[model samples]
Target: MKLDVTRRSREAMRAYLAEALDGCYEGEPTISPIEGGRAAAERQLSNFDVRRYASRNHVTRGHVSRMSPYIRHGVMTLREVRDAVFARFGRVGESIYKFVFELAWHQFWQEVYAGLGDEIYADIEDYKFPPPVWQETLPDDVARAETGLVCMDEALRELYATGYLHNHARMWFAAYLIHHRRVHWSVGERLFFAHLLDGNPPPNALSWQWVASTFSSKPYYFNRQNIEKYTDGTWCRQCTAACPFDQTYDALAGQLFGNA
Candidate 1:
């Protein structure tokens, strides 16, 4: 005798079955799995080369070394990555300088975390202006990837499906959550930590604070123009929602903080 099941029950059964098979895979992953161990990391280091280091900010134009997972897990040391860059580019120049500056940020965050310990999870500085009204919990729309913002929804989907995002995309999403959605940074930080393969507590939490203006001199914001420029207008082209990021920086400042 077969029992009839509701749609919700069917979904539950599927999810349970998937969870049960989680680590039993003997075949290739649907998405390219980030290979583990020192050999894979070394290969990635070789591919990063010097040119890629110079173009890290050209999110839509070029590639970045997808080596953060290796770095985060201690499979590749920070010093080793730096040495590789230096060897390829020499000690000083715009490209080498930019690359080292970014590396320094990771070390700086680690130092701050070591000093503050768990306090790194809290607001590091007073809000530069009045804080926006915020909920401690992540918004349902963001969690469900139903935010109606094409750029944000796409970024969230990439993060969930691949466990990675371009660094610019991360900043854009964090700023949207903190200043635009008016959610606390901690909520976004926690969400990032949960999904990011490269997620480290210090860098994840501190970087969110940097975007929210709790650690920086002012909040970071991006409008439609900035997104279009960096993303090559892909998200803006087919977007149907009324874009909150459509305004100029001055206008956004006025709307977000009553300052222009």
Candidate 2:
């Protein structure tokens, strides 16, 4: 899988990139997998082409996430992913730039984990302070939250079927899950990462922490109006509704419930 990426798709991607790059970039590729981001970019750009790859090619949505499983396995490298796309459409210009930029985002997120290390696992600096003692078992409410009881509509249902959420939906969900539902971020993180196709450790975990006020940022807040407005009528579980993290979750769920 990884080899195919580096060899075939990468070759195509690079071919395109080489052309798009032209005299515009002489110094190097922005990153190199071998020497690190900067070096890798420079090295890969060394020999590139434009005409051969990017044009008239169909970069499938399936293709976008296909490599992720392999990437998780470590058998496939980011270099291969980049090369494949670039070699194919590097010359295609702006379109490929967006694609490449997304790939770069993947790289950037990985570095966030690498640089932050266990700190990614730590509690956020802001907020009133004691970490909520988590229960041994997740609450019944947690499962209901997934049932779309919180926000029932096409988009919420889509999350269940597709096992995915859009960027905005995800933030809203996370906000609802943490601040409104009153659930522990760790529980929410595990549930999400366990299911999401695009799950990456740092981003998944840390971002949840961010929503949970376990991160340094101010606690996120949303009412029903925000959900109704943004989802374009796709979902409408008012913020006033029950959430996994709401104060009620603390009162009624589990044996000890969470007041302990």
Candidate 3:
């Protein structure tokens, strides 16, 4: 079989991406946010010890692998990444299990896309709970990252700047957009796809649906307490907004889903 590839210098690639993504980004990304190519991916894979995987959700700790872009764009394959993990850690027991499971999630989303085609963009099943009214357009506050909710705005800024977010951050953002803002899940889905380097349609859309309660048993909502606990109260201390998320889950559910 014949193979073809296009390669560009780092400067040329950066300029092209900046121009191509022009207005879609809110701010300039970190310099060399991440590198591409197989070598870089392999290096990242090699660094994936099991200790970090165990603490991946700590926003303060921030111990993610940061290799989704490579996997998404085919710079590396899931099989190779998995084999590398196994080679290092030996069997698929507790130590390497979580990391492997994360890899499996990527493959599961891909398999769903392969089976469902474009239908992944639509709701996969009836919503278990009533969702708020759906707005087709992305809210200006969200797009501009001026939502006043400190954690959310910060997460949006990070996404715009890095083309990536921690999975927990992504879930919180999606839940806020769908359940709190009442924007349609599709609107947030498209925005994420536009900004994320690892933005594959199936995972993005389905995950948004999961947050929105269309693909899961209930909508996902988070409060200020949870944010404070995970993010070390960084966003909360400096926040000026009225803090809509201060309420309990029941209070939020009541306010968000009143008589629906």
* RMSD (Å) per prediction: 7.4, 15.1, 4.2
Per-residue C-alpha lDDT of model 2 across residues 62-173, encoded as one tens digit per residue: 1123344345445457777677766666535765675566567678768878988877766746543344544534566555454445453343444445555655566766
Model 3 clashing residue pairs (backbone): none
Better candidate by TM-score, 1 or 2: 1
TM-scores of the candidates in the order shown: 0.87, 0.51, 0.88
How many residue pairs collide in each prediction? 0, 37, 0
Candidate order by lDDT, highest to lowest?
1, 3, 2
Off by over 4 Å in 1: 1-32
Candidate 3, TM-score vs. the true structure?
0.88
Q: Per-residue lDDT for 101-157 in model 1, tens only?
A: 878888998999989999989999988878967889988999988999999999998
Supply the global lDDT for candidate 2.
Answer: 0.54
RMSD of 2: 15.1
lDDT of 3 by residue, 61-162 (tens): 767788899999999888888887777788667747888888899989889889999998888887766655679999899999999988999999888877
Compared with the true structure, the alpha-carbon lDDT of candidate 3 equals 0.82
Q: Which stretches of candidate 3 lie over 4 Å from their true place?
A: 1-32
